[model samples]
Target: MTDLRDVTLRDGLQLTGKPLPTARKVAVVRELLDAGVPSVEIGSMARPDLVPPLADTLDLIRALDPDELARCWVWVATPRHVERAAEAGAVNFQYCLSASDAHNRANIGRSTEDSLAAMPRAVAAASAAGGRIQLCIATSFTCPFEGAVPEERVLAIARDPRAEGARDIVLCDTLGQAVPTQVTSLVARVAAEMPPRRIVYHGHDTWGLGVANTLAALAAGASEVDGALGGLGGCPFAPGASGNASTEDLLFALRPSWLTPSSFARIVRLSGALLDELGEPNRSRAAQGARTSATAFPWALGAEVSCR
Candidate 1:
């Protein structure tokens, strides 16, 4: 089974009007964990002034139990970011950079080469903090500024000597612009050519192909994928990007062992409440479908069993 890392509390809150309180964020993390999501990205180390919703990432990190934190990820764009977050009790780090220099500069205030050069240091910081790190390549498919990032540009970063110690390599569809064919081809190439590391696909639904591309990547040997609870999120830096792939939709399609009708109901309920708090519409088709009056459907949240 492909491991689905739910990014609701982190990426899902990015574009929302109000950030959830630290207590609420902690509760959401536990709810997802209780529901058996194997992994989650709870927050990022982006400049709080720039990304206000992510301001309390450190507080959430400190509040979580170490065991709970182990299965969670926090985003970082530099060695210093990783170091600071590690000190704040974050255990797993996703060191992120963009494939294109222009996007990297726009997102993280640095060149692509500068970010690549910082990888080894970030890896060392995670290791020294007794945690693991993953290399997350944003704009792996396309750049908002540059447009249509080359496949080789991404492959080169994956193959970079500095990226060696990363346990996983995540290819991000930052702009949600990649088609299934593009996702499949790149994932296949990386799986075949790159050294053995867990291949992860992080996609967006801007073009409505998020689920399609995720399945394609999984078929091409991606071991993990990312999604968000209410399909909330978009890059402030990358225009035209929508939410990450919906966790509700992915669970419905993948049908993981943890997703019983009852557990699914709980997930939908929690996401509903959380989305309501954020004042963001639930963009998840599956979540909306479950709440519909189609109670005859086995997958409906309102239907545990059929009366007929």
Candidate 2:
């Protein structure tokens, strides 16, 4: 079965200039869980100055109902962040490294080599702290500053994490420039080395191929995919990058047998509410089309929305 992890609260809200109240973040997460989303990246343990919206990451996690929190997976950037989150009861942690040196430097003020060297430490820390870890290879396809990244470069980085006991590795289309062909080719090559279930695809929708590329990856044997609700996420540090594949849109495209029509509608309504709350234009094509075709979206009609 294809597993979808909603990243709206963590990656989605990071770049938005406005900060979402902790209550709203908790409410959205609860809605997503109720809608049958298996995993949710509720917040990141990053510095407040770097991303103001996630400043209250710990508080947000604390506010979640224990039952819901038990069902959630959280993301963090470094071993230090992982340690903190694990102490606060986070069972899962995600750390990222860019395949392109230039993008790495621009993103974390560090070189790709330095980041790769630190993987073992990060994984070790997370594991020792009783947290399951997933490693993300950012700019796995193309980089905004460095252009196209070689598949070998990404594969080599993947080796480090895998060796450090990271069974799940997410290949990120940091700039959203990857085509389906590239996704299938690279994922196939990676699956040849690792188990197919160990691979995940994280895509953005800048070129409108997010879902297409994701489908290609799944066809190529990726076991999981990552998306944001309302398509609300972009890398503030990665220039030219856009929001991720919309959760509602992906569900609409895949029409998974497990998701009922009522559940689908509830997810779409929650996505619409999130779009309205962010005061941002609907980045989700599915949401926009639904609003246009039906008069049911009172929030979309009542408000003037602008894109980020």
Candidate 3:
């Protein structure tokens, strides 16, 4: 019953071998919206020189219509990033920063405190553009350079006065090292103690606990969760990080009200085609299981779904 924000285009394609064309990205977004996904992280405002694959984010933004843009999120770091993306018609901005100083510096080129200090301006920019903003805390669980991030560090960012106007707060396991217990504790604390904004869980599958941690976060009060098709994503800045939680797997497990059997089949086929086009392996067990010959299983894809 929870909302799944598919990050297939933004995070999923980050580590891919080739960049997807703007027309293809537009088609995928339309298909995803048609298939019932509530939100999609379509792209980022990060420097093109740093991540060449996502360099076309602004073009993709221009391709989507306003209604489509409303359901899509564009990742940003500073106020100017938000402003630029807003000019490109991005309505939802996910202003991101890591919980640790090292990872924050590595990922966004600034300290965690500096990122927090800029949130008020980022929020204002989103408001000025007549859109909404979400505060996204990366490295919420562990940082590649500094190791474990204390729970208090994440809480402080969430409770910061400058982060006032964000509509939601996303806690990210950038390195995928957080177990279910860690996810549960932090998510519960944020829900019970922090500002009354919605909690979002963004996890990676580095240690094979992405789904478990996601379930834990949901149980702890995360109404929305992020995942990528075929589990394709890794922080370019965070060494040792791997793919994201699988969107196909989450759809099967969560079974939100809008998701029908046909819709699930469509999502599976779409993910399969995209992964095949990129020549990437499918890391989603649920996605693999869905393609089984056993048609009797309710979760199994019927003969109609095939990317090959």
Q: Give me the candidate number with maximum lDDT.
A: 3
What TM-score, to 2 decimals, does candidate 2 have? 0.91
Q: Residue 1 of candidate 3: its Cα lDDT?
A: 59
Off by over 4 Å in 3: 297-308
Off by over 4 Å in 1: 297-308
For candidate 3, which ten residues in a row score worst on lDDT? 299-308
In model 3, what is the error at residue 21, expressed in angstroms? Answer: 0.7
Cα deviation of 204 in candidate 1 (Å)?
0.4
Ranking of all candidate structures by their lDDT, best first: 3, 1, 2
Per-candidate Cα lDDT values, in order, are 0.89, 0.80, 0.91
The digit string of per-residue lDDT tens for model 2 on 68-158 reads 8766777665677777877777777778778999988877778878867777777888788766788888999999888899999988887
Query: How close is every model to the real structure, measured as TM-score?
Result: 0.95, 0.91, 0.96
| Candidate 2 lDDT | 0.80
Question: Against the correct fold, how does model 1 do in TM-score?
Answer: 0.95
What's model 3's overall lDDT? 0.91
Which residue window of length 10 is worst by lDDT in model 2?
299-308
